[model samples]
Target: MAAKRILIIDDEADVREIAKVSLEITKNWDVATAASGEEGVTLASTYHPDAILLDVMMPKVDGLATLVKLNENINTCKIPVILLTATIRLATQPAYVEAGAKAVLIKPFDPALLGGQIESVLGW
Candidate 1:
């Protein structure tokens, strides 16, 4: 099978690097990183990744806002998005789901299991 392509959008460089390495090493997936939501949205449209790992908090455009933009764009709307957040409250799940997030992954996740978690969430 072709390697799954994933785009990770996070303000933290370390997080993006960790996720890139984790996904690449564990699942042998094609991973791309964006330092901000704007870049992530641009890449999502052009790269047409299989899925997106989006951080919930950002300076200008937050994850929810970014998701909305992706959903608005014809090229990116179909791609599934999984939010990575430090704050995961039960009340927010419905909001995230309603905003088109496939799942919400808690922060400080185990890099070794990141690939499996994504696969499970995406049903890949």
Candidate 2:
């Protein structure tokens, strides 16, 4: 099978790098990363990744807003998005789901299991 492409959007450089490496090493996915929401949108347009790992708290455009914009675009709307946040409340799950995110990833995730978790959500 062709390697699945994934785009990770995070404000923290370390987080982005870790996620990139984890996905690459564990899943052998085609991974691209952006440090901000704006960059993420641009990368998404150009890369057309199969899935996106988006961070919730970011400058300029937050994850929720970014997710909204992504869903508005025909080219990106179909791509599954898993939102990453430090705080995941039960009350917020419905809102995230309604906003088109496939799943909510609590921060401080297990790097070893991240790829498998994502694949499960994508039903790969």
Candidate 3:
């Protein structure tokens, strides 16, 4: 099978790097990362990744806003997005799903299990 391509969008440099390495090492997937929502959106359109790991908090364009832009764009709407965030109240999961995220993953996740979490979310 062709290696799955994933894009990770996070404001924290360490978060981005950790996720990137975790996916690449554990799943042998092709991973690209962006430090901000704007760059993430642009990459999503052009890179056309199979999935996106999006951080819920960002400076200018937060995850919710970024998800809206992605859903609004023809090129990126179909790619499933999984929200990577610090724990939110469980009640908000449905809200995030309604906003277009496939799943909500808590931050500080175990690096070794990141790909599996994504696979479960995306049904890969």
* Top-TM-score candidate index: 1
Q: How much lDDT does each candidate structure score?
A: 0.96, 0.94, 0.94
Listed in order, each prediction's TM-score against the native is 0.98, 0.97, 0.97
Candidate 1, residues 27-103, lDDT tens digits: the string is 99999999999999999999999999999999999999999999999999999999999988998899999999999
Q: Please give the RMSD to the true structure for each candidate, in Å.
A: 0.6, 0.7, 0.8
RMSD of 2: 0.7
Better of 1 and 2 by lDDT: 1
Question: What is residue 67's positional error in candidate 1, in angstroms?
Answer: 0.4
Candidate 1 residue pairs in clash (backbone atoms < 3 Å): none
lDDT for 50 (candidate 3)? 96
- Tens-place lDDT per residue, model 3, 36-84, is 9999999999999999999998999999999999999999999999999
Candidate 2 residues 1-124, lDDT tens each?
A: 9999999999999999999999999999999999999899888998999999999989899999999999998889999999999988899889889999999998988999999999998899
Superposed model 2: Cα runs more than 4 Å off:
none
User: Candidate 1: global Cα-lDDT?
Assistant: 0.96
Clashes of 2: 0
